[model samples]
Target: MNNPTRTIISRRSRPAKEPLSKDIIVKTALELLKSEGSSGLSMRKIAKALDTGPSSLYVYVTNHQELSAFVLDAGMESVVLSNEEGVSWEIRLYETLHSYLTVLMEFPGVAGLALNTIPIGPHSLALTEYILERLHEAGIHSTSAAWGLDLLMLYASSVAFEQASRAENGTTLQAISASYRSLNDKQYPMIASLQSELITSDGEERFRWGLEAILQGILQRQSKFGI
Candidate 1:
């Protein structure tokens, strides 16, 4: 058998010459994550990647959880949020969510971190504020907007995690399509009948459709609330 190609974040042979810092640690951790996934990340691995002792890492990050939190926030900072005026609230909200999901997809390991950690980073805070503000501006009720943001985050993170997990398992979505197509028609007539439509998306079509459906549902409810 041929050797599998190894893909790492950075091709450089040497670690960065900069002094040890939280930024450096977080960057190195991200690089490690790109190659190793969440399960492969640890203080020892990070320290080794940085050519430092594991104990020294404690000065920058208190523990694994804190380090993971930092990584999560760093990923959030990479998302570019456009707060341009005059854009429809629906468009702005959709763009913000798409940007957030794009960032998480780029750093799949961060999906794990996002789900497990609470982010207070400036970028994360800004995203939350932007979403709430846009929703309220759209005349969505305050309560609905708050819950809507939560629901959106949950959906985005879970989607990112599923994509990452499937990639790591060396599984293709075709497997899912095959399984659905093979289900017994007699036992699950509706699912079996709809299998073609259910499994036919070109990856992003379904995500976009789902996002629009969710936002439309929320907006319909907001209209009912008369807010």
Candidate 2:
């Protein structure tokens, strides 16, 4: 009799016969982004990873820009919006934004890609819808709420890009602090006086502080205009 266990093992170890689809290309591209940064990711590298040629990758993705967009959207697939009810919009917004940040930051170069790409993918649209819905529920006027989405996304993406770029450049907060401390006090007395406050905050602390400030400004505008 044939050994069923050996057959199962062989099947499990078999390589895929058809793996050149768009999904497979995007998945492999994301892995390339992780191993090598944005500058390092190329069609040639992805093709090599898949045991194919660079020309073959163009059949799935037109070019590097399109591939980058796909990678960014794939990274966003991990952000699961919470369903816990009875929470205030402020809390919901905070949690959602944090979750979104968490997802982007997990992929080193993907965050930087968000700066240029228009978010039209399925997951990106879902995130935009959820953010706008929360802002509307929080008493923001239609005009303000719509604009707030733009500002919120720009802020989050820019922050993530900055963090990622600094990491790639081997820069640290301590080095920034030292640079600030070395500034000519006479030329920048105000910055010199507040040096400690400017450079003392860690990444998470600084991010939370700025996020709270932006949210407070939005709430204040609503109250001021009675929207």
193, model 2: CA deviation in Å?
0.4
lDDT of model 2 at position 112: 75
Candidate 2 lDDT tens digits, 11-110? 7687776658999989888888877878557888888888999998889888777877788888899887765798887777777877887777765688
lDDT of the candidates, in the order given? 0.80, 0.81
Candidate 1 clashes between residue pairs 3 or more apart in a chain or in different chains: none
1-227 per-residue lDDT for model 1 (tens digits): 66569655665876656899999999999888877888657998988888889999999888888888778888888776777788877777777777787788765688888788877777788888888888788778777888888887888788878777777787776898888878889999999888888767736777778778887888998888864
- List candidate 2 segments past 4 Å from native: 1-18, 219-227
Instruction: Tell me model 1's lDDT, rounded to 2 decimals.
Output: 0.80
The alpha-carbon deviation from the true structure for residue 187 of candidate 1, after best TM-score superposition, in angstroms, is 2.2
RMSD of 1: 8.3
